[model samples]
Target chain A: MIWDWAFAFEILPVLARAAIVSIEATLIGFALAASLGLVLAVVRIAVPWTGWTISVLVELIRSTPLLIQIFFLYFVFPKFGVVLDAFTAGVLAIGIHYAAYCSEVYRAGFDNIHRGQWEASIALNLSSWTTFRDIIIPQAIPPIVPALGNYLVALFKETPLLSAIAVMELMQTAKIIGSDTFRYTEPMTLVGLFFLAMSLVSAVLIRSLERLLNRRTMR
Target chain B: MGIRTLVTLLIVALGVIAALATQEAYSLFLPGLLQGAVLTIEIAILGSLLAIVMGVLAALARMYGPAPLRWLATVYVEIFRGTSALVQLFWLFFVLPQFGVTLNAFLVAVLALGLNVGAYGSEVVRGAIQSVARGQWEACTALNMSRPQMLRRIILPQAFVAMIPPWGNLFIELLKSTALVSLITLSDLAFKAQQMNQNTFKTIPIFTLVLLMYLAMSLVVTIGMRLLERRASLGLARGKAA
Candidate 1:
């Protein structure tokens, strides 16, 4: 009974514009997490004494809420003289939170690579960097593509939380429209529809990427 | 000393120094944070109980119930799992008012979280049930057990052991999610941290104290879950074999 097609059509362009912010956060955030996670995974494996320290840090990041992490970076960090813009802080918190998960995925992939591969690289006189880049990382990456993709979808879904810090993402835009027009049914539903569409598309993309990765590995 | 131990000590030392320097801020804010922690725990406990119950029912409906019920369950899971929990809360808090069914903020938050987590938990439940070997299903059928009796007696016991670790992960996740309820204006831990920060303008100490409080709660949950998991897994092998 509350549905309004006119208002739905009216507010959609604004929502679409805001969806770009959400998409940007997801892409940049996922990039930071994926690269940082690879580094953490490698450091955890290569550096003996540092592994425990890295693990503890990762565990701390993993176990706490991302919102608190964002709040820390956005509100508290400036007090300690470490200032960042709200957008940057949101992306960083999401990146670091998911990096903990990604590192675990990479670690499992690292563990799965045959021990002989490391020994073979050593016998061939490859440097540690070469062994990691050429042997360990290549083998470690494919099995993890699916997991990384899942985090991508997850990160996309989590973008709305950035709205908490006033980032003007899709959800925030929808809320603003709803408050202004007092027509909640349209804008909020549109936001959910936008998210549903994005997730479904990502699910399809991940499935194909997984198939491609499996084929590449088989090859 | 190992680099790990040294680093940990250094981190701990920094925390001690910060606490000492901001002793007044620490004293004034700690009580507020603790009170907020109680509310956080309450939301988490109630939300998780709802989620687990909804999860069990949904998983059963999707995996074992008749066709129309399966479709209904699938739609429920998809709509919930596919969206953000924040938006779900907004829908309940904002949109539902348009339909003349306004829930109070606390109830709205709990419903949103419970439904969102329940969607994820249903997947866990479904996967756990399916992981109970196919042969077990056949064996139950051979024993002439009624469907309800078989599920209650045979399937659930085996499924429960497989369910524990993931449930633990979900439990921690659900607890952390209590932080989000603050968005709906619940006076929970995260909200309290922000409120104190706004009031005192001593953002660093208040949030630092808040972060540690959350981390300590998480550690407790992790430890409690491990204990529960250990107990649940006891004799699981023997049970599965029989």
Candidate 2:
């Protein structure tokens, strides 16, 4: 009752295939969030007029569950003449939900850029674009990378929720296997271990990246 | 129109559209949604209470206990934090019976959510406790205080201040996570909304209503937490000044 070695071995390969979908969803979703979040952060700053609306939108997204957002996009959007497959809907919901978090991280980085840098840019008669590209962005981005990396790991953990919309992600596949064979322990435990391995490896990778970014900036 | 006015207009238009879309749904399924909302709240409140307890105990063990206890705490934290709460719930619900540890659905939901959230909360607690000034620890020790007295009288109060904001954030996260319980057949808010979707096939209105309901509850939780934080910080300030 405590352990089953052969069954665990049996499920490992099955879980691995499903893990690929989980990884893809995480990567694509994170890519969407990272780029969209940067755009959102810059837009809010550059267009103060849109700040309130954007803030409201971000807050609304952050406050609600990703599950509801997925449900809304999957089911409701079609009624309004937009259609998305399960994978796309899951990716979009997760990506958008995390964009709200990423935006705050970007905003923090942007805010941390000191007033002196802006004055220096103005003194040199550097165009705003040149100033941002040359000075502000380079300084703003390094500290933000670590935070962004954390969201990547979080997005990976959240990939399981895609199972709800029938995405056949790692967790869903494991659930299916469990139901079919009535051997729940092995597959479920393997999924947890699967997540555990990825999470630890990501954490280590992010730490090293953070260290690298700090060193590069120091030079 | 000004931006505020425009934003207001947009929101009003959305409300009008929702009202129009959900005319029949409002009458028919409102109670079901409300019942679901109540269950969601119950699960969230109880789960969070258990999480805080687990977090504090784990933090305490990690910080002050000997080698094996610390290792146990660390392993618990990492495993729970690393995994998905949804997967954790499924494992508890589906897998436990195989091992002859069959609990009911509600208890499983609470345990899974509590353990998942408690892991993260333990880190928060540990970080806050460590961030308390070294001088405070030395001062208490120099006064010949025992470990328990030192922690209770000196360390915990200050550390508690730093822990509140993060705890508030975790609370909202927990609230949003309650939506996942519906997948485990918990009859929560999300489950009822799914039932509505199946029955009416009106995904638009039902899901939109559920979304708004979640938003409303989240707002309540956030505002309530802010008030709690303010009250707690005021007490902290008084303690420091005294």
Candidate 3:
């Protein structure tokens, strides 16, 4: 038997539990990315002097592989006295890495807003904070939601890389199962299916969220 | 650049050089890492070529082939695209032997990464082909060209230009993914770093060097893609000017 249904069923519970860790990592990492990315994009725009440094930092992060970045966080930072657990280090690396990409998406969104809108906010005597919070961000976010959602899915896929750091995510759990039982097919295939199902679900959710935003903005 | 930016860059350069100047560690680490980098580059290049071929065929079949081929292409793209690359590599490396088929680690690495990226590349190909303009297709038909001839002589040439930038992005992505091949026991860059770190406990220097090497390779991919894009577009510019 190339694939044993019984063995697959037996291992389903363990893989599913590990999947929660993967999902938590994705959600937390994405939250950090979403917020931190916005801040980075805003800082670049608002602080003209910081633009060069920020852009260079963004490009450096974007160009490198996430696996090494995670390793750097997990291993190197300890030498500098900033120790982080495997899970935290992995999530931070993924977050900061994706934040660079997400910032670009946000920048494009911000760019799409007409200059007159900023001029109008100034004319109305709105504080800069009010202008951004009540006006610019609301306008900027809708157009870029789908792009941000793509990153969400991308980040989810990246959680498997965290296993490289021994974070015990779904892929790591599956591999451990394989090593223990000496049966690779069922566990590996199940992990693949789990990723496919989750990504497909996220894609659908992103589409509906885009439509929802479009409707709200239209009204 | 501003003086501050220049200073910052200078400091970083000095730091990197100072770190690498540790003669004993440099001698120990560089050779193994470089050897691994060679294998990494080999996998990346071969994988990219495979990805391009798979992408073009899948995109063409999905767009124009018979129903069966189209369905097969669709399935191939989705399966490859949806799963994480690690799972796919493991399936090929570990599970295939279960069914009495075994491939070398290097072969599995290239096949898995290539097919995975090929799935993403197919979408880029499909989009570029679609963007080639309706009139171009109509003109090809009006000239009584066969389907293959129409695509070969007309559609693909124009589409190739659009494809270059996205294909560059995918190629860089493929290069990064080659790092995952190390997990299957290939002595690629990431695997080499981990192996050395475990042995020497020189985590900072080793991982930093690995990160910089990857960044350097990706930059090469980025710059190469830009030059290709510029060259590809020059013919269109000439035709318009003429």
Candidate 4:
């Protein structure tokens, strides 16, 4: 019941090892979400029909809870004869669920671009790809970087849900260590501390990025 | 007319058909899913109510209360907002028990969610109240209306209306966050899906059904919210028009 430094020291290394897995999942998951979200946003904007479909798909994904989605993917895919490792399944499910929200962020970014910019791009007879890459993307991305960075922090916190599917991430590793030692206090507390530390770091990093982006924009 | 549309249609059609073909399995899972749905609704409704209350209190305290009370409220908001809900949930459910304050899983889930959502909702509530025109407050003061009376008669009604859309979205987010409760052994919809998958070993169909059921629930909520928003905004529009 008391604060035990000895136990805390013992669990810190184990949890830190598991923390690496969490960091990996978060980075890969964010990368997947960012790219896929951008593609979905582009598809939705350029083609009306595609937009409608993507909207529906995004809403469907958003409406459902992520725990269910992760469960579904981890359990269901193997039945269809495509078995993924726990880590891959966890990352994929998290990536896919978050991509729906990121797509919304991207859509907002796209919408916030002034109509004049689009008209000008079209006026120059530039291809859609060139216009997006050269003008629209540069303008849209700055405002969204903060939002995307927030999602990265969000995705980091959500890595615990991977424990449910047996991914042995930080939370799962902590749970294992706790159950084995019959001492939940140290491991669980350490996990909470780890999350708190990482979240604080991410928040500070995001604020600095926002400031940097603002300075660049002002110039 | 184009290949992309055709491909999307094909994928969607296939997903739906696959969902329907496993109708019997859905029947088996429906009871559990429905139970989970009840929990989901309970969490959304009760958690939202708690959040609104906490949000209003926090906002009011920050805006008008004593300095220490304002600091307390600000600290609460920052801590909850800066942390993840999942971590908060775990700390509440798992760590709190070690302190001999063993809350039930359902209560733990509700408290964790309510507290987290309350932090976000406080901002919405605060902004909505602040955005009420300064002239309106001056008018109330000239009328010699007491502070409480002015708030009740003039400010809150308008603020509540403005808070609707963001609150609606928050309700949806609350609905989704309820799934995390399954981790603490709450038999919510997500838990049921996991159970059904374990039993049948047919993961895809059961989950597809769950996805559709969730979609149906969210769509219904969205429609209801939209109607309420329209009704609220219509009153404002009519006032403007007059």
Candidate 5:
């Protein structure tokens, strides 16, 4: 396990290439989770019958492990003639799993809204959609942004699970490179470092967003 | 009529439908899947037991130990809490073997999950113990009770009762987190479902079964926890009512 600068340099480019895939998966997964979570939350809160059903669905999704979901989607779905590329399946599974959590954030945000706002909206005879858009959402979203951002960082760390399903994300690439070179140290260390760096950056970014959102909300 | 009841009924209907649709496929994999489910339960229960032990020890160490021990406990808590459990699982399963300290998948999964959950649980334990009134501690001391005796008879009992809700939540989390062990080839429910999917190529049916099983497991845990909470809170409930 001697540090070989030459070996490190040789593998750096490959590791860097794999990082792009990891980032893409993280971003796509985060986007899907955020939007889907919002929809699930809104539906759960806005429509009683649908809300209860979605609540159970979300809970089931949340209680089960993401690894199983990813494997199911990636390896099983194709048997049903619904084939997704590894990358697509990876992101979709991650997104769907995290969406359950994100929905809780949204639910909390909705709960935090003042009761009077709902009454005021009803007094004005505003439709549910209009009332939610103009009044509740604007008030609900800011406080939750930081929590949601934290989940994004969490989602980034989870990208490694994608490798289990053979998505060739950063960790997978490291495994590949390590096995190829008969040296696990360099690639695995680099992968760990990559995670450390990305998580640090995201933490800082989320903290700043929290401050900015707080300042705006205070006014 | 409110939408809540309607939605509940609909979701229940959907769950029943999903289970019924998957009945034939589920029967085929039922034996293997149930064995996996047993493994899942074992990991969940054993991991939770380990977590409770570690959590109480770490919490005690942090509260009563020397400054250096406190710092060590703090570092342990922060590192585990800050990172993803999946990474910790990977490190335990993959990296430890490099150090010639290899463990089977089941052991590694339990250790990793226990350590991770213990980190979180320690905070809850510490908080619950601290929330016990100052008067209670003072009264024990005034009665000439030794520190360990006081802790065992007074402080810990109350703290343990208070710790139930948080522990319940963490148990649910631990149950879910156990799924990661399948990555290392533990034949837990997740792994079995994946195997069935690979063998039968019946994706929807297999996964539908997995989802329902998980839901049922979690529902049972949740219900049991609620009953425990109710039993523990009986005195408080009477006081409040009076």
Candidate 6:
């Protein structure tokens, strides 16, 4: 039979457990990307001395494939006495790679703020920290929430790359099922459906978030 | 001199020194890696052409075709866009044979990547086409031109300009994704790197070279797209002046 429903049902529990790993990786990686990206963006802007170096680093990361980055971290780092487990390497690689992208989104968000807003904060004799925290971040964040959400979804899709490092993510688990039973059709199809469902759910959530933020900003 | 210039020069010098120090390693790895890179470029170019064709067709179908075509196009775009490229590649590579359809690994790579990127490209195409002014459509209608005539002559030229930059981005994306083909057992660039790494256990130099090669290709794509954008906008401006 091309597809065995009974076999698919049998593998559901294992695949479900693996799916949790994938989800965990996505969330942790995104958190790292988000916070680290904001710092990278802020440093590039606030500390003029570091701007060029950060820009070059971000550009290099952005242009390369994430798989190679994972490989570099997983394989090469061990030689320099900085070994990482597969899951850690995968998460860090994805987090750092997407951080480059997320930083750009943040930079764009900051750039869109009006000059008057900054000048007003200065005229009020606000401290830099207070101005940034009170004036800049709240305004900068809302508009970029949708962009960051897109990266979240993108990062989720990237979780399968973790499988390449043998992290036993959903794709790797499915591949193991296929190899063990030689019945790939069911496992592959199931994995694909899982991804489709998760991504669609995330897309709907992001749209509503955008609407909710918009309604709040309207007031 | 500014610190930035000194830093930039220092990086360039380091890169040169690294290359000089690694000459023996380069000769050992370059032939296999270059052959893999050629295949990588081949897949990227062919996949890009397929993606452009699929993207245009799907976008037009969704926008202006009959109900069934629109429905089919929507399904195509959503399903392809929703899943990971690696899953798509594996499904095509490993599962299709169960249904009595066995494709070559190379063909499967191109098809999967093309369809996946084409899904994203469809949205870009749709947006660019929509950005063409409503008044232009009215103007075409008033002139008694057919739908295809209006789209071909008036709408597409303007839309094409906007599409180039995004299309360039998608093309680079397609190039990066070609790395996944390695997992499907095609000896693409990433596969060669991994294969070489396993043979010699020289992780640093192998991966470094591979990363630099990918970075160089992506830079070329960026510069090429920028040039296309410039030439396109110039033509439009000149046409307006005339």
Listed per candidate, the RMSD to the true structure in angstroms reads 3.4, 3.5, 3.0, 4.2, 4.0, 3.0
Whose DockQ is greatest here?
Answer: 6
Tell me how candidate 2 scores on lDDT.
0.87
DockQ, candidate 5, vs. native dimer: 0.45
Chain A TM-scores, one per candidate?
A: 0.96, 0.93, 0.96, 0.97, 0.96, 0.97
Rank all candidate structures by their TM-score, best first, as comma-separated numbers: 6, 3, 1, 2, 4, 5
* Candidate 3 per-residue lDDT over residues B1-242, each given as its tens digit: 23344345445644674578577766578888989999999999999999999999999999999999999999999889888888899889988998889999999999999999999999999999999999999999899999999989999999999999899889888888888888889999989999999898899778777877777777677767777778889998897799
TM-score of each: 0.94, 0.93, 0.94, 0.90, 0.86, 0.95
Better of 2 and 4 by TM-score: 2
Better of 1 and 6 by DockQ: 6
Candidate achieving higher lDDT, 4 or 6? 6
Which CAPRI quality tier does the interface of model 1 achieve?
medium
lDDT for each of the candidates?
Answer: 0.86, 0.87, 0.89, 0.83, 0.83, 0.91
The residue-by-residue lDDT of candidate 5 on A1-219, one tens digit each, is 556778888999998999999999999999999999999998887888897568667767776678778877787667777889989998999999999999999999999999999999999999999988999999999999999998898888788888888888888888888677767667766776677667667778999999999898889
The residue-by-residue lDDT of candidate 1 on B1-242, one tens digit each, is 23344345446644764565467757777778889999999889889899999899999999889999999999999999888888898889988988899899988877888988999999999999899899989999999999999999988988998988788788888888889889888999999998887787887777777777777676666666666667878778666589
TM-score pick, better of 5 and 6: 6
The clash count of every prediction, one per candidate, is: 0, 0, 0, 0, 2, 0
Model 6 DockQ, alpha carbons vs. true complex: 0.88
DockQ of every candidate = 0.79, 0.83, 0.77, 0.64, 0.45, 0.88
TM-score, model 3 to reference: 0.94
lDDT of 6 by residue, A118-149 (tens): 99999999987887789998999999999999
lDDT by residue (A108-211, candidate 1, tens digit) is: 99999999999999999999899999889988888888999998898889899998899999988888887787788888988998888888888899999999
TM-score of model 1 (CA atoms): 0.94
Please identify which of the two predictions, 1 or 2, would achieve the higher TM-score against the true structure: 1
Worst 10 residues of 6 chain B by lDDT: B1-10
Q: What lDDT, from 0 to 1, does candidate 6 have?
A: 0.91
Better of 3 and 6 by DockQ: 6
Cα lDDT of model 4 by residue, B1-242, tens digit = 13344345446644674568568855666677788878878877788788888889999999988999999999888777766687788778767878889999889889989998998899999999988999999999999999889888999888878888788788788878888888889888888877877887877667877777676666556666767877988898898799
Which CAPRI level is candidate 2? Answer: high
